[model samples]
Target: MFAFYDLETTGTSPAFDQPLQFAAILTDNDLNEAERVDIRCRLAPHILPAPWALAVTGISPDQLVDPDLPSWFEFSHQISDLIKRWAPATWAGYNTLAFDEEFLRQSFYQNLHPNLYQTQFANNDRLDLMKVIYAVRDREPDALKWPLDDLGRESFKLDRLAPENGFANHDAHDALGDVEATIHIASVIRKHAPAVWDQCLLNRDKHEVDRLLQSGHPVCLIERFGAAQPRSYFGVFAGTNPQNNNSVAFLDLDLCDASIIDANDQDLAKAVAASPKLIRTIAINKAPNVFPVANPRSAHGSLAQLVSAHPEFHQRVGQALANRYADKEPAQHVEQLIYDRFYNAGDKRVLEDFEVADWRDRAQIVAQLDDLRLKQLGMRLIFSNAPEFAPKKYRSAASAAIRDRWLTKEPSTPWTTKAIVEKQLHEIVCGEVLNMDQICALQDFYHARISEIDI
Candidate 1:
């Protein structure tokens, strides 16, 4: 089974932005639809939608704050329940691993849901169709009609790719429309390039990916760096990151030196850190576009064998990978601290209670949480959803935070601010070609949002 899902969000920052719509379809192994859901919610009080994002998605201000829609808190519960009901399936989407997955994870986190990684746990796995498409394009170029953008470059955007490949009504930015288009493209690949599709499904499981990488065999890794064309490299399992099992190191056989395996710790670390890297890191959990190398060259096999024989070298590589982020600053915002630590069992139980409690009692349940981050987030959630239920201090503090977030002049802040939206609206009106109606809609959204800010 598979769940093809898509999210239409307010902005790109997963830590700060929120999802406005979540649309998904449960499909059989062959991409036959079984069940579907389309969920939407009113905007959170602290969120100011990006003018450009609203323009792109054709979402108006009235739609964002519709009185009839469920609150964001209720919407999160509905999404969580749907996922639980459709468990043990491969959750998939177009470019979901890079974007939608993060948003979904953050949504669960902010809502104080017990399981932040619902998609990856409980026999559930994930597949990013965009990543699979990249592999298919590299290995089976004629499998589908590849569309080119206006600049004459190969286009992989779902809107363009789906229509070019025979999907007649490709709704570009709508969440549910994109989900159906994704399933159509997946069906094409499944039919035309079954081998590629099977390999992608097999690699969706991190355990399977680990086994393959550790089998002392050469594998083909397909990756696209920036705007460059997708390319395939013969890679061998070099090591696994000591700190995170999900992150594994693979030596690019095309660029590696056999002698580097015997280098000292400092030299090997430098080699791992070098640009145009000899070692490429792969996030196994991301459904990396890795496939077995057919008719491997003798030299490639020999290099892979040498790397496998040296366990000490693997340790050093893992250490080097771990050291790469040793100097990085810790996350300051609560949103960015999602992965800092897992909740204790006590907090998890309380969170389970928090979900069922009435809005008036949720504040008391928040006090029972052991994790400070969860407590803070829980208070904010209460203030956003039902202010009268929140403690007076929390309500006052949340209001002040919203004011500073919206009215701040800081240019580098991650969240969308009123001034930033104003500037973006001006740029869109001046530079981008837009009809007068579209222009007015954007302006109306901006003015309405600004007027609501108490400051």
Candidate 2:
């Protein structure tokens, strides 16, 4: 199963930002649609969207506040239910793992759902079209006609790429429109480069990762940046991730050399952790765009030569990583655990229960759970699912806890007050920065709420 999805949010900060609209197209392995979901939620009472974000989405304050629209909490439940119904599917979209996945995780966390398991459990995994594009560009530039931005650099933005490739992306920023575009792009990739697509598609299975690491060959490791273009590195299997058995470690062969094997335990540990000094590891759940090195770059030649000549290189690298993370505490943060490959039997049972439980019963059951980790998880669920049902003090404390975790203070109170509305209205008309389309959208927004507010 593959669920191609996209989201339009209040801003870029996943912790502080909230999704205003959610959309997905559920499909089988062949790319035939199974179902489609598109939802728009009333802006959360506490969220104050960035002006540029609002302008891009063209979602007015009036539309967000309309009684006809579902509340954020209600909409979150719908999103969660739909996602659960399509569980264990590969979640693919343009830049989704880096952006939309975070929004979805926070939504589940804030809505009392077991946010952790949904993306990782049942062999579920994720793929990024953006990374795929970069990999193809590097390996076979002629495989697909890559689009370029105004500056003549490769442009992977969905809106631009869709039209360039004959995919219809109506209303670029609209959640459903973007989902359609993503699915179209993915379909084309599957058609033109099935081998590359299959290779890059991540698998949550630990054995699969182990097999890759044990292969003793360099693989293409790809990473994409939000601001910069994608970069690819040649990496070789080094060892098992010390923290997660399900994850295999890799040494950036391009950055390492023969001198590594002579290093002591302490020196090797320090070297593994240091950037540009050699080794890097990622979990199966958070795997990147990786493929077999079919056409190695010139820079990869040196590492390839070294590995071909040195039989003991990997063994030494493995020992170094083990020494580095030996006594370190396990990561406690959700972000850190996204890449976690290992989950004990008890953890698996908890996740299974979470999946099978009736949505209404989850909060209460979690609240009464005894395990410290389970207790912490349940508290988040209770606070997100039904704050009114929780003790008032508990609710306040929960909110404070999330705020501290996000490292954000609440924005100014009464965000929709007359002054703010008037200021937005003025920005629509008199502001020098906004383009005509944005100004027009903002003006229409102001006109829509003329009867409700003085602004």
Candidate 3:
């Protein structure tokens, strides 16, 4: 089974911004649709919608605060339920692993959903069609018609790519429309490049990827760096990260020599961190574009065999991986702390219960939570959903904080503040090619939003 999904969000920061829309199509193994979901939610009161984002998506002011739509909390529950209902399937989307997956994880985390990794847990896997497209472009260039951007460069944007390949009436940015187009593209891949499709499916399982990488054989790794075209390298697994098994180091045989095994600790660490890297760090869980090298280079094969025999070298590489990020600062925001630690089993159960509990009982449930982050998030949810049920002090403080957050003029703040939105609206009006009516409406929306902040 495959679940092709897409999201239309207020902004790009998965930590601060929230999803305003989520659309998905559930398909069988052959990519035939089984069911679909299109959901939208009213904006969280603390969020100031990015004016450019609103303009780009064509989401009107009325939609942001729709009285008929569910709160973001309810919207999270609905999507979480859908994920649970459609378990044991490959969750896929165009560029989802890079963008939508983080948003989904953050959404679930902020809304007190018990499992932040719902797509990866419970027999579920993930596939990013965009990543698959990169692999197909490298291995099966004749499989699909590739589109080019205005600069005549190869374009992978869904809006252009789908139409280039014969998906008529592509809806560009709308969530459901993008989902349908993604499904069409997937169908094309399966039909024209069955081998590439099958390889992608096999790589979706991290364990399978781990096994292949550890098999002491040369593999072809397809990757794109910055604006460069995708390139293939003959690599062998150097080591796995001691701190995170999902991150594995692959040595590009074409770039580094076998003598790397004899390097000292400091030298090995430097080599791992070098620019035009001697080692490529891959997120095994992100469905890395790695495949069996069909025609292995004799020299590369010899290097792989030499590196495979040196177990001590692999250990040193793992040590290098562990120390790579040891000096980085810890994240300060609650949103950034989603991966700081996993929820305890006790708190997880309480959260599960909190979801189904009545509003009146939710405050008590929040108090029962052992995790401080959950308690804070749960209290905020209660204050937002049913303020009268919360204690007066918390209600007052939360309201004041919301006001301060909106009215804050700190230029370095991560979220979309009122000041930021005002500047963005000014830029859009002056620079964008919109008519007078549209400009007036945007200004009206901005003022209306500001008036509600109560600062």
Q: Which 10 consecutive residues of model 1 have the lowest summed lDDT?
A: 446-455
In Å, residue 394's CA in model 2 sits off its true spot by 6.8
Q: Where does candidate 2 have its weakest 10-residue lDDT segment? A: 406-415
Model 2 earns a TM-score of 0.72
**TM-score, per-candidate, Cα-based:** 0.97, 0.72, 0.97
Whole-model alpha-carbon lDDT for candidate 1: 0.89
Q: Which stretches of candidate 3 lie over 4 Å from their true place?
A: none
Model 1 off-target regions past 4 Å? Answer: 432-434
Per-residue alpha-carbon lDDT of model 1 for 1-455, expressed as tens digits? Answer: 99999999999999999999999999998788999999899888888888888878887778898999998888888998888899989999999998999999999999899999999887999999998999988999899998899999999889999999999988889999999999999999999999999999999988889988999799999998887778898989988899999998988898876897878888767777888888889999888988988789999988889989998888889888998889999987899999999889999999989988898899799998889999999999988888898879877788888888898899899999988888888888888756788888778767776776654
Cα lDDT tens digits, model 2, 194-218, are: 7767777643344565666566667
> Pairs clashing in candidate 2?
none
Ranking by TM-score: 1, 3, 2
Question: Residue 102: error of model 3 in Å?
Answer: 0.8
* 343 Cα displacement, candidate 2 (Å): 11
| Clashes (candidate 2) | 0
Candidate 2 Cα outliers beyond 4 Å, as residue runs: 202-206, 224-231, 265-270, 273-277, 294-455
